[model samples]
Target chain A: MSPYDLLPRFKAQYDANNQEFSISGVVRPQAIDELGPSIALLRDAIGRVRGVLYVNVRRLTQMNNAAFHAFSRIIIDACRARPDLKFVVITSSVVGWTSRKFGRLSGIEPNITVEEYDSEFYPGQGFLEEGGFVPILRSQTKMTWRHERAILPRHGMRQGIVMADICCGIGDFAVLVQKEFQPSRIVALDHSISSLNYARQVMREFDIRGIEYTYGDASEMLLDEAQFDLVTCRHSLQIFNRPELILKELYRICKPGGRVYITNEKNSHCLGEPRAESIRWTYNEVAKLFGHFEMDVELGPKSRRYLMEAGFEDIRVETFMVTNLDGDPQDFADVIAAWADVYAGEMATRRGDGAEFVARFRQGFQDHIFAALHPKGYAGWPIWVASGRRPQ
Target chain B: MGPVQHDLAGEPTFEPMIQIDMEIKGFVSAWRHCDYVSTYMARMISQNRSDSVRHSNLFSSAFNELLEVAFRTRHADGELACRVSRHGATDRIELTFPCVPEERQFYEEAVSQVAGTEARERYLNSVSGDLAPSREIVLLELAVDYNATLRVEEADGDVIRLVVDLPLEGLQH
Candidate 1:
């Protein structure tokens, strides 16, 4: 029988391959003897491991003195017995206490170390988090809100529901949602510390309340299961190499019969009237460029398939086009210009693209902007909106 | 009989946010009361913070340790009252409960011990060296780790109050 059978309120897993032992959930046993099975499992796991043993408590939301004393004994005993074996305790900032609590172990043993598990969250999206990119994110959200404000209600968003916006970059969308839908409680979470800081600053400046901007990794969030009535992750899945992991988390957080709403773009579908060919070619290359980095920029149409595979029911999908005429043509042109600077200047150069290819790539975004600003011209970007209900 | 109020000169005063009073027997009847009270109170107080999830997590952890200590040390008779208040960035939690002379002495000594420079070292040793749970460990953790200012006061009758002033919002950094 698994050691977990004895501890109903918690889970303990030992991964032999990685020499990692993870304990998650509320561990508040009345006595240390109650943790016998889990302690034995840890001792056995430590006996078989060599070099380094990773203890991951990122998701351990609560642990009382009994459990803490028991775990401390195991760590101290293991250090004294195996002088060469290093112990690395992985903690999460989301838990708030794991880092400070486990950090003391390093001082007790020379071989023991504690590290917060947050690094390299979004691989090719680093440029999007630069200080300069904050304004662009705001502009992008403003442009999209024109379409999404109307589209949200159709996707099961309404007043008085508890909502969560995962991968909420800069939180402009959450602010707009709070003002419009008036969700009873809104938790806007993102992996970027800079983004969350900016979001908090914006909230403070605007005196906006009720939206909680939290810093967390999207794939393994600290949020409890079945907590949110509606969970929305916008334009985020396509940026991750493994969109399925994010989908699983979104699915996990949504209450039964609640909807998970997501929006993604098919970059190749970007169109403009006067400079249509150039815009199409550049955007298609944008798709290919993101593909080279393991991201799927063309995951828009495949949202239905992903949702179905993730075990969602009553799936709904729709597509909307944000055009230069949506509000201000200047805003659309500015977005394209920033995209050109990032895609051609930074992303293409980093990809080792030749001068000729970079020039051509730059030309396309410039032309798209040209069309957006032209009096008779029209520029449009298509986004696919999809929502599915978690099985009741 | 009533909630304890503290007003110090030149010190920032707190505005009362929530108060809960219950029989000490009902509270210490189950260990889960520590969890329930801490989690529920943390959620209710953290709703307006910049990061409610993070604030709630930290608040619950610190508050749970306090409640756990109270559970292990309280006298059997009389009432237990928990009051939470706020002033700017700081949060104040006042836990008033029935305590005999010995129980009050334990709290007084523990609060003084945690105020020493070696409080963190004592906390580390308390958790690592001893097999049995220590009542002073939670107080040390709050004083040293959470950077909370803890005070013990003797109230009317057989009741004693533990006041914890935590600048929780600043601790997020």
Candidate 2:
């Protein structure tokens, strides 16, 4: 048996067609001899590939000195041996160490280059994680929290349980959970550095303790299995192209018999008075707009099927509407205004929608905002809440 | 995020966080001990950081290097104590383990070399060199890559204490 088989925490794979060799997981072998199988695999990959050989370590969580030295030697030696071939080492910003460590190779050998793998995993991440969108996120959370604060208890949230808020955008929900539920421990993780930084700043300002705001890819988190008693991923599934992968990860981290909670929106269900037809037309377009980006904004009703397919048991699902009546009317209006800016302004423009289509799309959101702020009018945004237990 | 309130001495002081005391023999017996101890201590202390997971990963990697060095160099029969303390953005990891004369000299020289002007050059060479990985590579990493302050001194009798002050969270770009 190979040394890697003995220590299964590490995995190495090579795709010959792409000429890419990817390494993932923790690699902390005590001696360089133990890395023989991996090094051999890399050597073989190098011989077979031409042009550029991509060494991808976007998911490598840990690498000790012994492993680093061994890997560096192979790259440095290969660069000298194959002067015609270019080597690009792909690292992840989320992993924190791989970029700096592997980046040293680019300085040593001109043939070797280092590239931090950007957010190719989430197609819509850029539009959502921008600095201008942060306030909208906070307002959206504030609007949803009013309904969720009451609904969470029915879905297995309680004080003193260990919890994690995956894809915890700006961490407003985490702070609310910390204050309301008082989880003994809360690890709020997100892929956005600016969002995590903002979360940390808010924590320090409020002097709130116990929430660990961490940077990570929710699809493949480094957290140990079965560690959290309750794992909450709210209103984030619809943002990802492949949410089933995220649900699989949520299932992995959640403890057996523990619950994984999620909330998502079905944009077409959005309703408003005094311009109901325009609002409905625009929301249906909103769903299609998100679909153009490979996102499923209509994923709310599908949560139960996703949960069941992910092997979760005891699934419970509920729907709630965030209306202007829930809170200050202006807050709801602000959310609609921001959505108009993003969905119609940025997303629609990016999708190559013409001036006429953009005007109609923008009109729907404006009408929603108008309905929200009008003295006698009403606007409502529907959200689906679902939770499933990891089978014991 | 808040205004700086300096102490009368104008030097920031460390507040004790957490520590682990174990027998050197037991620690050195298994390689996994280094991984477990570093990961646990890192998780416990990184809760309040700007990015706890990133901090924990960085802290664990650096701390594990120290623990591995101690595991390789320590005397077989003595107490091994690992303590982590923090002051503002800086985290200090102090590792106390029993060592013989040669082991003590090895660490002292490594610490001195890390303090030299040519430390980064030496580190790059050591890590990239075709020879077997140098034992001092860990110290060089903590010094050059992490910009950590390294200090070593003789403790009780045969014990040597290695202190590494790492402002890891603050150093993130």
Candidate 3:
């Protein structure tokens, strides 16, 4: 069958001027035999065309192997029909389905070219729902303590040292850092005045003095340059529209011999059977919903490289797993549920399929609760804290 | 009923069809039902003998792989029509789903890319288990001999259908 017959199935469009074709939507199992005939009819149409023949799959939400192999055949056939054809498979990193790394059949006559590209149809709105999340985050100090143990600097908080924390939401980790390090001046900054006020309330409730709250852009802070003894940002850099700008600002503000610290959650792993694996699967899939963003939050080992690019010295990266081992599993459940509740509202406004997502998030959150119980221990979604000294 | 015909693998085959339209979970559920029913029917045909169990397992595995793909990439909109028929002793199952034009184009190309060589080895190793299963993967894992075909066809109402054909009789050695 002519490959063009499949055009309606893929919503593909061909532009004769550029000799380019682009397709979008979920690739089903039977894409080939369906489209092949229609495309075969195009051999004459393409054979007469000039320059490179570019086929773009970057818009696809996902593709299965059977479908991919099928599509590959149509391309090879077209190339054979038109030896001058230069087929380029444009790929995207938005979803896990499109592999940035693809394969080549060593001796294929017409070598098809593969190009990397990205088109973000929807940006993640989860960060805007921080209000529902921060309260739960505030109550999860046990997690903070666990992460701090692995990430905290070896030396205790030196006296008379000033520290700056960017995007310091509710100051959970900032308070812990100040308590342990006993830094003389703790400047906690966030874009949200409400979040800063909440952090202040936490400080007052604990009688933990030393942290000074500031409401402003964490990326473009008003703080003087090269002043603070230590500059820190945890779990929020990934949400920033431009992380490189903030990273540069973090480096710019730190005192030359001082250190800069940043941390993020890498991924989640399950130890139990089907239930654990199921939750992990659901969680990982949901995480992909947030992957269309320009910058990634889960830097993991890559954080060290980012730090190095920022011209930091003596970079050290440590991974801390927040298993919530010591905390009540209910705490994890409550947090995830609240997290979903918060996300549901904002996401509804951003996505056309927002309602479906809201339902999935709620269901996934509930499944996570069930999985959390009787857990022999879950690992991963590792929180990485990478630190580096600003070169003297 | 026509006279019984045996294939080289010594297993009988039949053709049947089914349809589906769902988001991820619903699709998965529908597929689970399909897997259970299809394998059960196969067992009845093969007569639950000692060797039949092995064939049943292979059937379920291949079917499960196809279901995984549908779960991952199949859109919630439109109906998915599945048909299973006999090719010699093999059951040639064909699944058709509504899709967009570009998607149809993409799959045609993907099929061509893995035409010859060690397609199964490269495919199985490259794909992360986290996503949908590939039909080819099911056959490869079972070490079975099968020929798979995927194509797009025009349906009524200007809708396009993606049709996948998998010929399965039983595991080879």
Each prediction's DockQ against the real complex: 0.70, 0.56, 0.01
For residues B1-173, write the lDDT of model 1, one tens digit per residue.
33334566577668887888889899988777887799899999988876788888888888888888878754789988898999888889999988888988888998988789888888888777888667777777888668899999658988889999888898885
TM-score of 3: 0.44
Q: How many residue pairs clash in each candidate?
A: 0, 0, 70
Docking class of 1: medium
What TM-scores do the predictions have? Answer: 0.94, 0.92, 0.44
Q: What would the per-residue lDDT of candidate 2 be over residues A132-158, giving only the tens digit for each residue?
A: 888888889998989899999998899
Clashes of 1: 0
Give the candidate order by descending lDDT. Answer: 1, 2, 3
In angstroms, give how far residue A88 of model 2 lies from its true place: 2.2
The docking quality of candidate 3, as DockQ, is 0.01
C-alpha lDDT of candidate 2 relative to the true structure: 0.87
Q: Please say which candidate is ahead in lDDT: 2 or 3.
A: 2
Candidate 3 residue A283 Cα shift, in angstroms, is 2.7
Q: At residue B12, what lDDT does model 3 achieve?
A: 44
Q: Rank the candidates by DockQ, best first.
A: 1, 2, 3
Off by over 4 Å in 3: A1-131, A155-159, A268-274, A293-295, A354-361, A375-380, B1-173
